[model samples]
Target: MEDTQVRDTIRSNIANKKHTSDKVMPGFFLLMASISVLTTLGIVIILVTDASKFFSAVPLKEVFSTQLAPLRETPSFGMLPLISGTLMTTLIAMLVAVPIGLAAAIFLSQFASDKLRRLLKPLMEIL
Candidate 1:
């Protein structure tokens, strides 16, 4: 009888403590979400503004003109060399990353025990 009364009292307390939307309201959360979104949009606008200024200062002729051999008069844009360098670097990075990433994933999945796997899964997700 005492245990039953104790359980009944605990249940009543929990029922009384139940949260209702009427208490705190939802508008506060909605306002915070809107502020976060607006801040992100403002950052994007600032970055685009800075990039446009940089592009505007450089002459299009220098970027788009053709290269010429020695003693030639043709206007030359050296952008192609820069573009090729960037592509080569990107390819090298991807080549190195793909094999290493695959190896790490295979090691984790195939070699780890269940307890280690559970711990590592969350750690990887956090990263």
Candidate 2:
């Protein structure tokens, strides 16, 4: 009888408990998300405004010109080399990383025991 009464009391308490954390958590997350978005926008606005000022002061032709200037002269600002380098590095990184990442994921999911998988998954993510 005591066990039955205690179980009933516990069930009632569980059912009656207000999920206040659920209500508060979304507000906290939304606040954090808004802060991040606002910060990004602020940075982008500063960059664009500064860039506009720079572009206005400097000649467009000078920026895009192909001839590499002599020492003691302003270096050519042609974007091709920088852009190509970025693309090449991106391609190389993807080629190397994608296969390794996929293989690790496959190994973790298929070969590892549940406890080992749980342990390794978080470690891999942190790395």
Candidate 3:
């Protein structure tokens, strides 16, 4: 009877421990997730503040003012060059990425053998 009581007590203790651990696990995960979100928000705020300061130093007149005719001689903002350069770089990057990405997809889906696929899938997952 004493042995039975000891066994029952041990079983109950283990069950209580498992229930407590399960409850605590989600709280721990929530804490980690909240920390990650706050860190990301902090980084974004810092970047925005830095960029705002950079843009604020430039004269608004230079940014928004339109050029007059050559005879009238008003200041030109000429932001078009910067816009065009950004577009050109973005287009070039897309052009370079699309073909390589498509080729990789095709090879993985159509050409790779089953064993190779299994091996590569795990490798890609680890990466």
Query: Model 3, 1-127: lDDT tens per residue?
Result: 9999999999999999999999999999999999999999999999999978856874655554344232345534546566677899999999998887788768878999999888787775563
Identify the runs in model 1 with alpha carbons over 4 angstroms from their true place. 1-25, 63-92
The count of backbone overlaps in candidate 3 is 0
lDDT by residue (tens digit), candidate 2, 1-127: 9999999999888766656667788999999999999999999999999999978976788666555453536656665566677899999999999999999999999999999999999999996
Q: By summed lDDT, which 10 consecutive residues of candidate 3 come out lowest? A: 64-73
TM-score computed on alpha carbons, candidate 1: 0.49
Clashes per candidate (backbone, < 3 Å):
0, 0, 0
Candidates ranked by lDDT, best first?
Answer: 2, 3, 1
TM-score of each: 0.49, 0.58, 0.59
Q: What lDDT does model 3 reach?
A: 0.79
Compose the digit string of candidate 1's lDDT tens values, residues 6-106.
99999987776665544455677878999999999999999999978856875676665445233456534447667777899999999998897787678
Colliding pairs, model 2: none
Give me the displacement of residue 117 in model 3, in angstroms. 2.7
Q: After superposition, how far is residue 101 of candidate 2 from its true place, in Å?
A: 0.3
Rank the candidate models, highest TM-score first. 3, 2, 1
